[model samples]
Target: MQFRHSLTRCSAAAAVVLLGLAPGLPAAAASSSTIGVAAGANLEGISVYDTADVLNDEKIKDALSSIDFNEPTKVAVFSRQGEYSDDINSETLAFAREEHPEWISQDAEDYGDYWADGYFIITLSVEGHGDGQIGTYFGEDRKVSTSQMESIHEAGYEDFNLSRWTDGVIAVGAKGAKIMNRPWYKNPALWITTGVAGGAAGATGLVVLGVRASRRKEFEANLSTGREHLSNVTMDLDTTELSARTLPTGSRHAADLERRFADFMAKYRTLFARQQELEAATKKTRSSGSGVALSKDFIDTAQQLDATDDAIIAAAALYTRSATWQEAWRAQTAPILEDLAELPELLGGPDKKLGPAGSALRSFADTAQQEVQAVGTDLAAQVIDVDTALDRLSELRKQLTERLDAYAAARIGAYAKSEAEEKQMRAKLRKQRYASTGTRSGGSILDVTSPAEFFWRVSAFNIGYQSAVKAVNSSRQAASSSSGVSTGYSGGGSFSGAGGSSRF
Candidate 1:
């Protein structure tokens, strides 16, 4: 069985070889009136012949017509001495010499008279043929081997055939015809059979390859799109959230809060300074209040202190709503409470050695202590509220970050996919170009087969369409978000008649 299989394989190979060797059917035969010429060059008793009869033959002429021959065609022939007669035509020889000046003659005696016998060579130059010209030569004697002649013919024929096809001719050879017409020959036909099977198989293969490439590209594009969307979302979310944290609820509200606090602090410091100054002034004044208006200065200082205390309370209320102040209060509450607790011990110590004005200095120290304690208590209560607010804000921020991160990741994926799809598209474009003959209606040099350009055009169109859809959706979302109303205070002021202030 094994030997039989081997024999079968050998027979198949032989059949294929024979099929290849068989002469292809000729198209139209050459006109009988078509003139054919033969020429030869002889030197040092060595002769070479050129003939046109083989080129003018029906099959040869048809093959030549399909090609564009722009260069001269050359061929070599080998034969024994009896193949040529003693009679030689000088006219044809002269024509050969005139037309092909580059034809060289070598001394046969130098090579032991190897190719000294008669040999006839044929060269064909078809006018207007750009690259296809067939030539054959037969020697008059056994000067050159048969292999040499076969080699020359094969080379010339192959060159002529390739050139014709390359020049944009749709000429079909025997192999092409068989492949196009036979369906059972294809491997797939073993399982699936149908009419137009060959063409269908070719087309299906092409489409399958194209679709596979397109799908790969789309997958890459989708990944890239996801990534980019994720990135954009992350960035936008970060920006908005950070802005919400940093930017005061309103411009005027922030400025007013700062201004009021600063003014109150300044007045409090001034009052304290004035009290010292008043003590010094009292010491410098005569027994009767003469050098300065003591009553007026004291009254002015008292009134300033009263006004500043009012402002401090108002500013503290406004500061309670601020995110920054809330954060600060939460962080500093413990330290502030400690400071307040230690103040009484420091103030009540025997070191209550008030400078010259003893009784009045003692009274001022006691008052200041009480005021600091009250302020501390109020601040501690407010810190609890601030901590609660901060907790909520932190939770909100975490949620936003997670959302943005997911979005950014998705966007990055999308961007990468888009880029990959582009590459796949490029490859598909190349395949498309190779599959088709990119010739225009007219015979123009502009005709081109470029897969790159085709892929780029297709990929670009898809990318643009997808991007437009995304843009529209994004626009709608933005419009919807913008439709709601948001209300906040313009500046630091009380919402009610009683001292209640809201600050962003």
Candidate 2:
């Protein structure tokens, strides 16, 4: 029986070997991130080499040697000091090609099958700060991506900056191992290389898995709709701007924004365009009663659109206060602090009221409070502009809100009599949050863009609260509010090699 099971895995691995016969367009990308510190990881049996002598090499190796990597990937660190350039990305790829040609994938389509052949190559070019300065290279067998590379780079940000080079090495290795390791089921060659009886079951499972894919896809539809409605009012906002020309520049901006917003509601009645069409479609969708089931397509699209809608409404409110200056800053800043202020209610002190997750949430909350306060100081001192302050605050809001919502749901879920109820409740929370954005539009981008008021509102829409809640520097947008695709590779690979780079 054990042999049969192993055979089953081999068969799947064999089948998966054929997955990438189609050509994969090569890509190179990276991003920047800076967060507080965390502890280092153990890298016992892994092969690590420091091609560039930065000092304390043996010490780095010794600390990492504490943990065993049975898959034990080889790691090579390449360091140099210079200005930021695209060369770092290409240079890392070149090092792998020249020194470790054996590591490149024999097949062009290889994506994480031969794990043992993978290498984590870190290229550190210091005397540089922010993004794309720290480069990473992964062997074809290892298959790291742009997003994963960024996470790995971020893992070592603190240690790397302090020139605790080895500690930085250990941090990245631990992170890479954690990210690279996957279940045996992932190896297609392992599952299908053996025989027939197991192959049928495996194939069937793959097909069934494809049936109801993708909450992200669903979320996208809604976000796309919101963008359409916003764009529609572009000209109207433009007109408002023109009308305000008689006023002084700052006053014109203030008058223009106010007029644009008023026109938005007066013309279309709150974010929707062609109200009659939407009402007509609603009546058509309903059968004999008021209750109508939303299609999966409709639900996903609405969710994403609403997230954008919330950002817009939140922006509008803040824009209104933009002229009020201090009040606008307060509006931009208060929600996150208010949310953090409630942490103790859920935390219940050191006793762990919500279990391990609760404790974890509180720890993050504390960090968030300090950061928010610090930013507030910066804003008051004029050390940072309002846009910059909003960028910082927006990121904090996304992180806290997502976590708080989850913790709140978990608190509610705790009372459910069954596991199914808990899951259902979680889904209900997400669905309701996505749907709550009050973006009632049934038209396409073109349809919504038809009105003169539409053009104008979208024109001024760029002004206010948008940046306050959408941090430009975040690694990736939070899932609850982001309009990105659900998952997978973020899909970029280099023709030169498989790995991508990230900033430290």
Best candidate according to lDDT: 2
lDDT of 2 by residue, 12-70 (tens): 55444444322452111110112111233323234444545553667656655554442
Instruction: Give the TM-scores of the predictions, in the order they appear.
Output: 0.17, 0.33
* Residue 180 of model 2, lDDT score: 61
User: lDDT tens string, model 1, 1-504?
Assistant: 999999977765554343342256231222112211112211112122324222223343344334321112332321111112111122223343465322323354333211112323433332233332323322223222333333333434443444432211112221111122122223234325333545887999898777656554443343344334333333343332333234344444334433434454455455456445544543224123332344344444444333323322322333444444433333323222333344344335443343333333334335534643454456556653422432333333233224323322333343334554444434433444333322211111111111222211222223433454455456556755442211222221221000011000
Clashes of each: 49, 46
